[model samples]
Target: MSQHQILSTEPKPFVKWAGGKRQLIQTIDRHIPVQFGTYFEPFLGGGAVLLHLLGKNPEMKCRVSDLNSDLVLSYVTIRDRVEELITSLQTHAKNYHKNPDSYYYGVRESEPKSQIEKVSRLLFLNRTCFNGLYRVNSKGKFNVPLGRYSNPNIVNEENLLSVSRVLQSKKIQIICRDFAAVLSDAKKGDFVYFDPPYQPVSKTASFTSYTNKDFTYEDLANLVDVSEKLSDKDCKVLHSNSNSKEVRDLFSKEWKIVEVAANRSINSDSTKRTGQKELLIKNY
Candidate 1:
């Protein structure tokens, strides 16, 4: 297929993730630089921003990474072995429909060693888990309970195909690595976006267990330091974090910090889900 035809579908994120930027795309887009070199996203959760940017700039070189190995593997599988992955998901969907509770827990408990099965398991759990939230226990296990969706779209074949096409580009590179690794490859004029798990505003709001290790205050501090170093290298940096005084204090006065209104859909209390603010830290 022609490049234009491939990019026309505009694939959305296949998995629902905590702190996904899908709802905040409009606000995030406003802060993006007019032009840049390779695009780097170290915290590619749901990849709402990366996919959105790719849809607009089809040929833009992108280097995205995530600490979650399974999540990173899913991107590679969808890009390379999409048909096989789809078939696996179809089987999962069929079995899940037979008995949602039993199948979900069974799949969650079984640690499939193969790549295809591992990614398939991750996708199945994410789709069926409570609120589509990806959380792990201290022992690094998928612990979220089954969600209450009457009918969930487990096999998103179309979106997966579109994602595969977009990701097949030679310019797009996905890897599993730490966020700080970008400092070695990112040069001047490149755009680096950091959407790390937001620091909790209160004790009750802490939910940064994307992996076994929670994104602690020290990680946030290190992230701030990394952003500062990226700025020194002349790269354009944009960051997303909760609107908290601690976050504001960590980022120095040199960074342009703007508070944008955002909704918190992960909150169990529907009343607490709306009217929240997030900070958009940038260095032009």
Candidate 2:
């Protein structure tokens, strides 16, 4: 499809990522720099902000990365092998419908070897899994149980197509790497958005296991250092994190911190999902 056609379809995040910015896009939109050079997103979660920016400027150059190799592969597969990935998803959907209970667990336990199958399995599990979460155990195994959905949209072909086309742009480069690596490439005038796994507000609220490795306090410290360097280089840096004392303490007074209301939809307790506040820190 043409680039204009792809942009018109409004390509969105293909997976339901934890800490996804879809809900906070309106507030985030207000904070984005009006003009910038290359875009950098080291902690690309659901990529809501990336897609939002791309939709507004399809030609925008973006460099996005994540530590999760499987998630990164999904983006590449959708961009290069979307048709095959869709076909594989159709098969998964067929079998999942036949016996959700058995098939869901079976796929969860069974890891596929092929790239397309791997991406398909991840998408299938994300769609039918509890709260659409992408959590992994200490051993890097997906452990989220099946969610109760009478009818889940397993095969969102149109959105996938849109996502695929938008990703096909040569200006967009997806990589699997540590978040701090952005320091190597980010330059002055670039816009860098950091949506890292948030510092938990409480002991029970911690859910940073997007991979087998939990995002530690040490990682948060590294993020602070990186943000500081990026700020020194004059790069437009915007960050999101839970409104916690630890997070607030790390960022200095120079960074503009805005407290925005957010919903914690991934929380098991529905009552606690609302009335959450998140910090949006930016250096203009």
Candidate 3:
């Protein structure tokens, strides 16, 4: 690919995210050759990969899905009402930053359900939450505490509008469903990228609880099955996971596994947040 290809494309996400692949995008892109048909991404967390691909490969026909309803709603709402969301986000930025403690927990207490409230609460918490980590308890509440940042850019109108343009493009389809459902519609020559919850590298490291539901070993095995089936049909597939023996062994024969560095987001100590190695498996 040309050096100038991705230069003009808009930049990556502004929001801090757990397991976000912004740092790994260039490496991932280098590994993935430019030639491909359509693009598919299941388990789309912050969608760093999809958005990066969209910017780099404008010709891509894309389909992306995620299990989180709130995430899906946020994306859809932004796609449809980006201008309105931006307006509301400006208001949120103004009000929440002024009285963060009250606004943070107030929205948490209000149990707001309407579109306005839901989007506002979602954006508010996302901006203020510690490291932008979206975690919830078994009761399904927004439980992440307020972060340390004094002034965060809560409203980014240009990026929101660009995302809306991408979503509005006829070539893309955004779905809210089980990640496995993505495999059903994927055809030959399609490219699939799975950035699922990283299987813990160590016993102490395993915190896959993005939701109440656990992404167990069984789920990993299921994903391996999906990858193999897709590979058999000549689909190009790539997955990112922790560099653990168990994760490595799961795709032992069928995948081309490579190790690369990744930032550890869950650790409490800022010093421990340095780059650590992770696994990248591709079906070539």
Per lDDT, the best of the predicted structures is 1
How close is each model in CA RMSD to the real structure?
A: 1.8, 1.6, 3.8
Candidates' TM-scores? Answer: 0.96, 0.97, 0.92
Instruction: Write down the lDDT that model 2 would get.
Output: 0.92
- Per-residue CA lDDT of model 3 for 1-284, tens digit only, reads 23344244474564445688888888888777567777888888778888887776656798888888778777788778777888888887888877988877777677766775677677777778887887878888778888887887678666666666666767888888887886788888888888888888778877777767878999998998888888888899888898888888888586799888777767777787787898889988
What is the RMSD of candidate 1?
1.8
Error of 2 at 223 (Å): 0.7
**Model 2: CA > 4 A from native:** 1-7
Where model 3 places Cα greater than 4 Å from the true spot, the runs are 1-11
For model 1, which pairs clash? none
Backbone clash numbers for all candidates listed: 0, 0, 0
The window of 10 residues in a row where model 1 has the poorest summed lDDT is 1-10
- Model 3 scores a C-alpha lDDT of 0.78
Q: Against the unseen true structure, what C-alpha lDDT does each candidate score?
A: 0.92, 0.92, 0.78
Ranking by TM-score: 2, 1, 3
